[model samples]
Target: MLGSSDPQNARPASLDAIDLSMLAELERNGRLTNAALAARVGIAESTCTQRLRSLRDRGVIRGFRADIDPAALGLTLQALITVRLGTHGREQIRGFEQRVRSLPSVLTAFHVAGADDYLLHVAVESAAALRELVLEHLTTHPHVRHVETQLVFEVLEGSGMVPREPVHPPHV
Candidate 1:
């Protein structure tokens, strides 16, 4: 599920050195069976299950997702849009998130601190789509003050770059 939580999914303990071995094993292959994970962690399968559950419940383990290629989906254009807000208020942020989330081309939306108040990762089929997304949809939103976008030239996928398990960092 995209946003489901179970009490059993909680972290064991972060203070105690995370089983580096377990992490390394998971890093190598996220889909390792529970039995295999237990064996790699040198613990009983039940113990492994309990620890994994605890890790999940404590918000350590988030969820699993597949990384797909956008180009394969006919979305060849990728752009990063920097958005400036007309006003800094809780309501404005919520409005921005609501509008941004409704757009199909937005892959990710981030509220950042600095020159821009928000950053959006968008993928589209063509320059026209990009223009519609930035000029028509994003800029015209009620809370949006100014917007700037840059095309992406490359994307990287590899080890140490992607997380094996799911984790949601606290949203500001």
Candidate 2:
């Protein structure tokens, strides 16, 4: 709820470009202290703290998180599986989504608007394990009409879309 979506009700007049700059710095390095963030964004430490509080109040600043490495955690194999459902109705889509989400290997499932109605990002131990995942999980589902898997030979980037960058403050 970072400021209301309603344009008229959004950020207060006192909140300006400097506050936004603080937010941007936090986005790049979530673990940065208020003092550190203040220095980087060239604001007073107390002002940085207050601005951060305002951002939090508005719901702009969500909880901080550590980025976990899946590969290091022994999740080696990753693939993108495009699933074509037998029917594209809303109920069917919801049912399929719930079931697909329940699978252990299915990291993310996106209902796309192209040739495939659903795109699944999965990670497993090996190629054989991937085949088993496709067989035991995806194909067995009732609404699943066609399942196409593109084995990720090498990951230029690992599974799932990177989050969009936080909007930067406009130049003064």
Candidate 3:
């Protein structure tokens, strides 16, 4: 969930070696305790707290969330649904976005550029459930022009968002 605009986040902040290391470590594991995080990042506990606060305030780090497996919750099937809009009216777009946010099964929604207006990643219990979701929540919507669904076979997560420039230097 993206947070509301914070003016502080609009401006960039200079992050040092210590900051980068902390971020990389946290990306791998966000549940680390303050003491553990400090130790891993080679910094004092007090300094670690300050750095974490700065990262949050600057919006460099959004809030951490539990990575849940849909299958564990009995949502066994995942699909990517692309939705085409009949009209590009502002109200229609806003209404569609609002409708999507109300759906419990939608994991992510992208307002993309191309033939489709929206791409939704959703998880459901079975193929029937997937079909129901597409027909009831999406294709039937007045503004929707066309709908396409593709089953997902596998998902692989990437090493998230680490800066390439000025790679974390070796500690002296």
Candidate 4:
């Protein structure tokens, strides 16, 4: 618990060593209890709690979620579907995003800048379901000009961390 007079309540210009350690530990396991995390980081439980609260308030710690296995949930097949839009209007983009997000098969969708307008990460049970999704739902839509799908053989997921500063080689 952070007291009213505590200096830590003030927003830090940059994260300190302890803050980085906390983030690294949390990235490894989001469900760690305050007491457990404190022990791991070699800090007091109250300080750990205050640091976590500060991180969350500053939007550094976005949100915690359970890492679910899609395969275990009967969504074994995965594909990256590239969609080219007929128009890149605001209304059209919003409509396409809304419709694509509505589909249960679509795990994530990105409105990207590349050869394609949108990239969709989809998971389904079988090839038949994938075909139906592509044909009946995507291609049939008025906004969708062209759709291409590439089957994913394997997916290697990460903690989604981006370093703020460039790393240089250590001097010998």
Candidate 5:
């Protein structure tokens, strides 16, 4: 919760230009073959494998996932729901986080700064479903004091985006 997305507890790892290039290429195409990646990075296949393993071990490459469209899945509605908690106790915060993680409609949840405590990216089949999600999973919680929802008109994909420089991930 200290940062937007912090690294897991992992050893400190430095990145060279080659590593950065591999990361950029992977960011563009996570499903690339090892040989393709090696060729793109101008490195041997064995070296690419080792480098990828090292990146994963160091918590650089978190995971590869499909970017599913909600509309294609019959979930035509998307929303950004902001939530504010009445209390900030450690147990309450932990409890709230655990509770939010269990919800299926939540695409992503951010324990954030500013006026709200959390911002939830959710997708649902209809407006009624969105209401149900908020009532059942969010406002019903004892600590949640306020909830606001905004409908999403569109979402542009940029999952492959990454900085050219190898930024150090803060150890969690």
Candidate 6:
């Protein structure tokens, strides 16, 4: 479900103003009831419910999740790890992703097109735990060739509305 918006689950041609407004409101507060969302968007409750269902069915809205605090879970240390793989074969990449996904400390992993093959966001208890994670898990892995860990001093997160229009214009 991670890449639900891929070609297999393509969305409608374009999202209308109402759809964009619903997304903006949901981005602010995912727990809003149908009545509340309808009131805010100036739509009937039934219409709001129908639109929400349509969004979900179209894969525009994947799923709702709670914002969990790493600090509350005693995971105070945060790090971004840049990983370069030794091999670019599909099997190797799939195996590496599967292995990393099982690690509890790893919050998110992005397969990127850059100098590094993948970027991992991890949260641990301390520097020692981070060292263990990198040494025992990442570097020791067969496919991983190089790993770089950068400590995160602070994480500034936002829940603003997603842009209705693309920042960059399409090529002529």
Best by TM-score: 6
Model 6 TM: 0.88
Q: After superposition on all CA atoms, how large is the RMSD of candidate 2? A: 5.9
| TM-score of every prediction relative to native | 0.77, 0.72, 0.87, 0.84, 0.85, 0.88
Local distance difference test, per candidate?
A: 0.78, 0.79, 0.89, 0.86, 0.88, 0.89
Evaluated against the true structure, the overall lDDT of model 4 is 0.86
Looking at model 1, which ten-residue stretch has the lowest summed lDDT? 1-10
Model 1: runs farther than 4 Å from truth? 1-15, 18-20, 158-172
Cand. 2 Cα-lDDT? 0.79
Per residue, candidate 3 scores C-alpha lDDT tens digits across 16-125 of: 88888888888889899999999997889999999999888776788899999999999999999999999989999999999999999999999888889899999999
Model 5 off-target regions past 4 Å?
A: 1-12, 159-161, 164-172
Q: Each candidate: RMSD to true structure? A: 7.9, 5.9, 4.3, 6.7, 6.2, 4.1
lDDT leader: 6
Q: Write the per-residue lDDT of candidate 6 for residues 21-130, one digit (tens) a residue.
A: 89988988899989999999899999999999888876688899999999899999999999999999999999999989989999999988888999999999999999
Ranking by lDDT: 6, 3, 5, 4, 2, 1
Q: Write the per-residue lDDT of candidate 4 for residues 1-172, one digit (tens) a residue.
A: 2222345574443688788878888888899999999998899999999999987877678689997778999999999999999998899988888889799999988878888998999999999999999999999888999999999999986645734244689999
Cα lDDT tens digits, model 2, 3-84, are 5656656664344668667766776778999889989889899988888887777666656888665577677988999999
Instruction: Tell me the lDDT of model 5 at 66.
Output: 88
C-alpha displacement of 156 in model 1, angstroms?
Answer: 2.1
97, model 3: CA deviation in Å? 0.5
Q: What does the lDDT read for residue 27 in candidate 3?
A: 87
lDDT of 3 at 66: 96
User: Which 10-residue window in model 5 sums to the lowest lDDT?
Assistant: 1-10
Instruction: Evaluate model 6: give its lDDT.
Output: 0.89
C-alpha lDDT of candidate 3 relative to the true structure: 0.89
How are the candidates ranked when ordered by TM-score, highest leading? 6, 3, 5, 4, 1, 2
In model 3, the runs with Cα more than 4 Å from the true position are: 1-13, 163-172
